[model samples]
Target: MTEGETPAQVGASSVDIKDVDVIAPNFKKRLSGVTSTIVQLVPYQMKLGIRIATLGPGLPAYLPHIRWTGLFGLWRPPVGRRHRIWHARRNNEMLAGLILKYVLSMPLKLIFTSAAQRHHSSYTRWLIRRMDAVAATNSRSGGFLQVEHTVIRHGVDLDLFHPPQAQDDTIAATGLPGTLLVGCFGRVRHQKGTDLFVKAMIELLPQYPDWTAVISGRITPENKGFADSLKAGIAKAGLERRIVFLGEVDDIRPWYRRLDLYVAPSRNEGFGLTPLEAMASQTAVVASDAGAYAEMIVEGETGACVPAGDYGALRDAICTYLAAPSLAALHGKAGLRHARDTFALENEARSLNRLYEALIG
Candidate 1:
């Protein structure tokens, strides 16, 4: 359902079994109870609960079963019938809710993966207020509320994302070796600003011959052509040696380790995780002058913040950093400190745990 729809209109039935005897205290653990039995147990079930229950054996029967789940006061009336709002933009909308579900779902006590799901129109707000609480993935998201919300920082795994004292193994994979590595890494998609970065790199490389552009990440089949286009631009500008497209790698920490700088120039964001990761690795960053970057970057104290798609400005910003390696080092160290204090895995986990406890309590 679209974010603009009402609870019932969006599929949130006003018929939540108000007297639920068995509420899954923890959303993560309760998620496992995907059975018809779950619906039967709820004294007063919500349509959302019914959706969760009917996944296994109920799936075969539940599609048709939902038609009759909301009859007039059936004693056990559709025990777990829920009207849940399910939204996706092009099937893979990158919202705060979606990111939280993917990144922290395993350890989470609750799940709410809808980017700006809460930022619906006034009509939608009436529907959303029915929920007990709203969980926002970041301050940018959480602060925007018609009601109460809990802000939880999304994070990376410290164990697997180990930074190296030496350069990462990813350099060999990136193929832009022996040069000053100024890189961008993530899912090689439009939102990451691959096009803008490529343009910036091309404009800057003539003067800074040794500087490299390492675009690392997977180019989905739909966007592989975009990657090709980037390659063509690199060639046309005679920047083949300066730009490297490491299609996709299993581990990317090495790429971060090898980088002289990391850049994220997205046009918009709820919170950008890549810069935090780069900072955690003691790498300097040049992120877009858009949402959440202000929370994470300093003009030149922690990292540089460049405009989203301005190649000329990005090139100049890169030059500013390149001109002073010591300054970059100082900013990188500051960024690392900020990331640790604000976005580290432990800090995130603790913040999440508090949210869960509040939810359960």
Candidate 2:
């Protein structure tokens, strides 16, 4: 606690634990400024550490010692920043946060992933400049930050998220061999701009033949109304013929394989993963300009990225590519190349390894 500063912000999530699977709601409830999230992989933290350390003590040299949590304690915030705030929205990097406050207080160099978080908060806007380096998951992420950190594109298991081994093979059940199928994956929320994706397709389907949109995602039980609303929109748009809702699936490969394009119309993001999954599946993408779209998409090179909430722009992008399948294929190939070059797991681990060594030094 800093001098004259109030206690931790109300609703702020706990900063103590790095285990994503066990994140507590009370943590965020206690700190107003913190946003809590679960990444689903913390139970394996200690096991992974032992494995890494076994590979050689060198492995943990740069990375945080598996037991550092006990030393640092939890949720340590700035001492004098009278109004320390948080903007937590995470899918995979919860562990990074455990050391964030400590990082802020030090002069050490660091690689900040999840750099493409979308926010207009004055506090967040101010903090971006204070970062030493950014670890942008996509080019669009790099662009929005207005600073070039490292271009570490998001990763995917190419071997797993690919099309049928034979590109020309008939996947009759999917109707993808002869038909152009465009898929949209991830959460089904208005903020994801599901309404806008449907509207864009509704307007474009009249001109495009042999094309359809497949949306796959989990509808929160509390947000069942949101899913229902999307269904209603699809019906109103008369796209009951052109759109397919697969709901949530435990494995996404089958869904990824039967697609020609992956579209994400999120109004905001640090980096949306579905499009990357699409790219990994050798499918082209058309995403919103918000977040990392600018960095990941090369306009006409890899995939198309358009501004969020703009139905016209969004529709035009989908149409332009749908009319030319080769263009889409080319972009998909580029995306795969880019992912392999920078975002591979080995590269991230290597970078993380260095980061840990530096931290402990």
lDDT of each: 0.56, 0.55
What local lDDT does model 1 show for residue 108?
Answer: 19
Write one digit per residue (lDDT tens) for candidate 2, span 196-304. 8777777777677678877887777877897898788779877786787878776677676667677888887765556666766667889997666666666787788
Measured by lDDT, the strongest candidate is 1
Candidate 1, poorest ten consecutive residues by summed lDDT: 83-92
Task: Judge candidate 2 at residue 206 and give its lDDT.
Answer: 62
Give me the runs in candidate 2 sitting further than 4 Å from their true place.
Answer: 1-153, 166-171, 175-178
Reference-based TM-score of each model: 0.65, 0.63
User: What TM-score does prediction 2 earn?
Assistant: 0.63
Task: For model 2, give the 10-residue run with minimal summed lDDT.
Answer: 51-60
Task: Write down the TM-score for model 1.
Answer: 0.65
